[model samples]
Target: MLTRFVHSGPVRLWTQHLGHPTDPTILLVMGTATQGIGWPDELMRTLADNGRHVIRFDHRDTGRSDTVDFTTHPYTLADMAADTTAVLDGHAIPAAHIAGISLGATIGQWLAVHHAARVHTLTTIAASPMGNNPGPAWTRALTGQPAAPDELPPPTARFLNHLTASAQTPRTTHQQRIDADVQTWRVLNGDTLPFDEPAARQFVEHSYTRATDLTAATNHDRAGRHWDDNRRAPLSAITAPTLVLHGSADPLFPQHTAKPWQHRSRQPD
Candidate 1:
């Protein structure tokens, strides 16, 4: 795998690519505040082994990408979609299989609708057709109302702490950071899958070290709140083969959340 930075508009994106250039491409777009490194390396390698080019990148406000405060000048889902296009443009990839999770999936939706020619296939995981439910927590956050404990922020202090501890020069507050990573994954873990604390910690730590800006997650949430509106074009506009994958026990996005896409895409659950 190679790690590099690609200029994408005002912000440069941190990218990782695996597999041969000749292989079919798989472009992975992660959810809001989700680090590209957090994506399973095994998955990338497996796809590469099967003769697929796997590409993943950190969004503007995540990982080694440039961090800009979005509070003063908010960006839309369309802007995010363009960022993906910029990424593809940066790599000179004509077209690729596009897959995203949650917020990233929503961006994928935009790409499929507005930038159809660039997408070979569309796959959304743990996402709603309209992006996400937002629910009570995110709703409150957007409205400037006091958020409940669960809805504090996507990239919580604990998550940052864990990232800090995962650095090459491990901090003295290592235990606390490790604990944060353990708890964070525990909360997001689906019912069918056991929480792998050790693995989770390692992944978070590695990503943290590689990240150029630890506060990118916080900035990502700002843009996320601005575009949290449940918006989507008619499913008929989507021409590529589409796949919607949602975990039955996903705490953030329940099965009902994925129902719209399944119903509209005419794909069986």
Candidate 2:
């Protein structure tokens, strides 16, 4: 179900509405460069069907949420975390079962660690624990580029392909479903249809600029600079019940990289 969300910013937030009203809340967080619609609806449905109230919303710079000028300040992950807190507070949700993927997953990681009071159980898929992975050499190289408005399309396509491929692969727990989803999203994202290249580019530029400097290097540098120059605080502070999920074939975040997180996760009790 698609619901109308007009609060929070200049542009109305577009979110997915599903499941029964009485179900417990499970807020789904989308990854970087992706809208909540990119999240698999079945997953939310299943959670709702299992007596959980599932919800997903677009981040400020993604989907139909309000867009801002990223050229002014260096948007840090911490700032993104604050936006999430505001969203939750506005919805009157003190805390809920939280789940996220990739950058969304990273946000969840930060939420559970720094803002534990705001989240209940936590689930992170295809994510890393910042600085733990250090990422790859090429990953570092990519982040070093200039973050201009024009640098949106190709990387956007490549990143989407990666997420689509990761969720649809050999021996995946949910491949057929993911394949259909990829097709559906492709249709929704097509230029001739509803959301075209311009929309896609806008979403990409928004995310890139929001969490990084206007003149910030591409995401590669955003992460690489942090990995090499920054010292990430430990996740040992996270007390929330946690679950970590990753695909063995994921090129961006391989299965082995999940080990660092496994050590810190409190059992979901």
Candidate 3:
């Protein structure tokens, strides 16, 4: 595994499970606060077995990537999109098929919209258009929602719920996923970071939407946000073929979101 600095040094893409660089590359961008290691092993291996040159990377401020306070430098989603492009440029990959989920999907949308040249095809999993959906309400904990501090649920409960609610897939012993999430979180956040309360509040504080956030925000939810954001440059603007996959049982983003993508994209969302 390698951690690469891109777009100067503030943002890093933690890379993993590398293959021959010459093959057709499928760049996987994970959701918020998740490292490259979070991608399911079975699914990742399946992509490799399918003869794909699979690549996964961590976004800035997440995982081992630099968490230095870029908050002062006007960090926007466009900056994150730039980071993805920089990673591709840094690795010398001319083009790639991009895939993402949730926050990753949000970034993928920005990549497709703002850095069209670097992406060959697009695959978005478990993501919506933008603001006001259940995503916003449910994520009030993460994004500093309800505007009232008293309404906030327990931080542990919020974190646990965030993991479960964000996932379209379900586990047999669901509690195991929660336990594993907490364990991994402990390792990632480190014992020195806030364990009980501070960490959760810290995460929640950074959740607000800034004016410079690149994606469109027309709809009440994430799906509409993406769709409306892309209004000036619809999915048809995407030169590459696209394949959008959605899980039917996902609690956070319903399967219906996939339908709009299918309907709107030049190929599919």
What lDDT score belongs to each candidate, Candidate 1 first? 0.72, 0.59, 0.55
True-structure lDDT of candidate 2? 0.59
Model 3: lDDT of residue 53: 73
Please give the distance, in angstroms, between residue 39's alpha carbon in candidate 3 and its true position after superposition: 1.2
Q: What's the TM-score of each model vs. the native?
A: 0.77, 0.61, 0.58
- lDDT, candidate 2, residue 79? 58
Measured by TM-score, how close is model 3 to the native structure? 0.58
Summarize candidate 1's per-residue lDDT along 82-120 as a digit string, tens digits: 889888887779899999998888888878877889999
Taking the tens digit of each residue's C-alpha lDDT, what string does model 2 give over 1-269?
74746454343455566676556678888876566765666777788778877778876666556555555544566656666666665556788788888777778878887789988989998776643543343343355543332111122334445556655655433444344434434543444334454544444444443332322223323432343222255666679999989755454543332346444332121
Clashing pairs in 2: 24-53, 143-220, 143-221
Residue 71 lDDT in model 1?
65
Instruction: State the lDDT of candidate 3 residue by residue for 51-147, as single tens digits.
Output: 7777776566555455534435445555666767767877788879888877677677667766788888888887664222343445665655542
Model 2, position 218, has a per-residue lDDT of 33
The candidate that wins on lDDT is 1
Name the candidate, 2 or 3, with the larger TM-score value.
Answer: 2
Q: Give each model's clash number.
A: 0, 3, 12
